[model samples]
Target: MTRKLGLAGVFLISLAVMNVFADRSDKEVVKRVNSIEVVALDSVEGYEKKYRIPDENLNDLFAEKIDSLLNSWYIQNVFEMPSGGGMQDSLPVVSIPDSVYIDRLQAIDSYVDLSFNKTVKNFIQLYTQRRRDQVEMMLGLANFYFPIFEEALDKYDMPMELKYMAIIESALNPTARSRANAVGLWQFMYGTGKMLGLEIGTFVDERRDPVKSTDAAARYLRDLYKIYKNWHLVIAAYNCGPGNVNKAIRRSGGARDYWSIYYRLPRETRGYVPAFIAAAYVMNNYKEHNLQVRYPDFPIVTDTIMINSYLHFDQVSAMANIPVEALEALNPQYRMNIIPAKKDKHYALKIPIESVAEFIDNEDAIYAFKRDEFFPNNEIINPKSSNSHHVSNISGKDKVLYTVKSGDNLGYISEWFHVRVSDLRYWNNISRNLIRVGQKLAIYVPQGQADFFASVNRMNFAEKQAYKKKTPVTKTTSASTQTSADGKYVYYTVRRGDNLWSIARKFPGVSNNDIMRWNNIRNANKIQVGQKLKIQSRS
Candidate 1:
């Protein structure tokens, strides 16, 4: 009987150890899932919040948020592949079915695989202390973004798992900026966003709007899939563009495989598809790495209202009893507090579902408040204010129409044209502190102002050319200068706390590459806080 009891005790101890291991494995999986959600969602929120600032502060704030999100997400997501052990060993192996394998093979043949190489692996591993820690940080951020991405993808009948693509492109960071000047979660460039009907101007950038941008991304991906009929090719096209993929296919003698033309693709484009696949794999199986994710503290549901005119976020939040930050998170496309300034324009305003009725009830009051704040100290005229004054002055022969870009404001424009914001407001008859894409304004400048502006632009262009010709191709200075007409050139001296993106926007037609080339900058990570360089004007 003593022997029997001993055997029973041994069994009990074994059972307890198994239970502990099981519990730990479950917890680790949960943690990883939560972390990914947080990273993705927070990135979305960060980008949206940036668009809520005033026009004058938009560019700098946008660039700052983009850089911050990019660095944070990249560090968090890029981790070493885990060795076989721990929870990963216990979990059931995910099998690639024959059909799936066939599909993958077909995709591999069509587009060049740009998987992370030894260099990228070494960089990520050496950069972070523990690979698991990096994974956990990225997973934490995913908690915030997956829901948004899933919803957007679902609406377009795309695979929900495709949401992880943002992790590869922008590390689920909504405000992420790429070396190629791609912006937001989908990493859309200016031209691509415009092609997808995403409006960009001084007042707002729809590409920064989580919902809108996601929708555009979905449509774009769908279109690519339709054209390529292969998921891998679609992803490659997204990274390097369909034009490049077509050229690559031609070069490969019509061999439609990523590996076949991998070496022929552009340096960045080669890694685009591989990074995506690896991200998807890691995100789906983070438990293998012992990563933990922290859940986000917000519900997924939000309310939408159709706004007919300009409205301020502060006013809406006050009326709805919601926090200003929450409102901004919900609607990130608006560059300023005011919506796009077009007559009878319909702006979709998002709010918490509970605040919908309250928002509607106080809508009139909000508009009245905005008008009052805009035209304070002005006596009420006998006649009611015409709607024309509120409408963007895109018409009229004497008017100068300006579409606002990522970094522009009255002050910036005034400085460029030697006018004051007050004068600009008066000349345009703009009220309510609102602006929009395609909105035209009447500038009461002297008759020769255009000519003078053109001449100044020419001089600036010339200065850029001269600088480019003289400077040795150093990475630091090459990245910040641009070529201009004539021998003269214009460049930006990087101020303290300056970033490449901010400097890039200071000049017109100056790309991120131009800045890098002028400054001879190789890796964007090496830029110091106070380095001075040349930049193109944003005029």
Candidate 2:
């Protein structure tokens, strides 16, 4: 009866006259139920902007939704510099002679500029001093990512030092994006990625796939090098585009030298070459600066499975016991957490190396699990229009405003307000997970619940700041949960505040990876409070 009612509701909603731009009716009608006034979504134009999600939000949403179910699930953690910190505070400047700098540059086998200029020195200071933590994290990630980068560079016969460009492009984040919409570690724009034979579709965006995008970037760099034959100019062209570099050359009276035409280049591009040089230097000499690599506990080893039929992340998570978040982290190419399998198309799903046999053994069961929930009725939209993502809310609820705070995402905010992510997206008319600090968001809820948000809205910024600081976030596990017997599996019941990262830390020899593999725990949603987790002791 419930299923029939749901289908009937879906049918009735589909029949309602609507346009791609909005859910609107021509006449404004006031609807009141139990003395509560409610506004229909279509009645307001551009109402979705009230809840607008940013383009960079999907991964954040996935992370927030899952929490720390799997240890170190980030496929590529984007390296961003600390907003404020100084070189004087962290490390002292060591005076090295100009001759030593020149000799070091000469000893290097790279074609790119290794010259010790003021610009290069400034960036070097920025990395070794102001951004030490970011650089240290980059060094840790470099251990895993650098080999892949070197392979691609070697395959294309490019300079090995060119690998550092990924550091500048995206800080080695495969899912990195610029405000201009350039994407991935290589930061390829849509046109360039498409031209390089990268497949981008509704279901899959290959730009977010590290291996494929790195190959594309290598080819692009090689092609640019072919034209200029100078690595510095090639790097400049890569940043500001070939047209701008060419214009800079013309402005400098056809000067081929990067430094000679540097003044004519874009302001940001001027810093680009220097930063690249600094990145290469820092990666090579991180230990000298007292920086240690902060590597993730998750192993680099993984295996890929070919998925020919439609596969949802939830199916893989439930049947294979791989956390859905891990799957998303490994296969970020799949937007909407969907591996759309057409009859003629094949998709690749990567999982931890240990989970391969289990995945195969349960392949049939995975495909058969919850088919209806994963692939529901195809929501109709105007494929031609950009502003076509619209969700209809038949349940009349009043909209409330919430101010976004520091360390907030859609998932966290949704949980706090007791609202669905879909509803948050629908109210704001945004498709992605990105929201900004201090941005106001519109949330719809019952009239009786209006006071809750009203109280939140009444608080000033300073009051909110104080409240956030007063609330302690870190959770600790009991000492009893820490000890495990050798050659046996111990079961620990999940607590309300427990996450995989914390759980792994409770046992000395155990890691989140071990827990993920042993219990088939992958998705954050799969693990709940009071759930029993299997812990295999390595001791």
Q: What does candidate 2's lDDT look like per residue over 1-539, in tens digits?
A: 00011111221111232212243344543233232222332343333243211111122211221122111224322211222312223566666554444444455566665644556655666667755655665665676578888999999998899999888777666666666788777788888788888999887899988778889888888877766666888888788777777777766566676766767877667777777876777777666667755444433457889988887876787687665546666777887777887559887888867578888999989987766445545332223232333453637766788988776778756644555577787778766787888889998766555654455555444333222211111224343244356637777788754666546645543555457667875443357877878887432
> What are the lDDT figures for the candidates, one per model?
0.50, 0.61
Q: Tell how far residue 492 is off in model 1, in angstroms.
A: 54
Could you estimate the TM-score for every candidate? 0.47, 0.58
Give per-residue CA lDDT, model 1, range 435-510, as digits (tens): 6645655554344334334422333322332221110111344455546676356655555534443344344434
After best superposition, candidate 2 residue 343: deviation in angstroms? 3.6
Candidate 1 CA-lDDT value: 0.50
Runs in model 2 deviating more than 4 A are 1-107, 377-410, 413-539
The 10-residue segment of model 1 with minimum total lDDT is 1-10
lDDT of 2 at 286: 69
Task: Candidate 1: count the clashes.
Answer: 75
RMSD of each: 22.7, 22.8
- How many residue pairs clash in each candidate at the backbone level? 75, 11
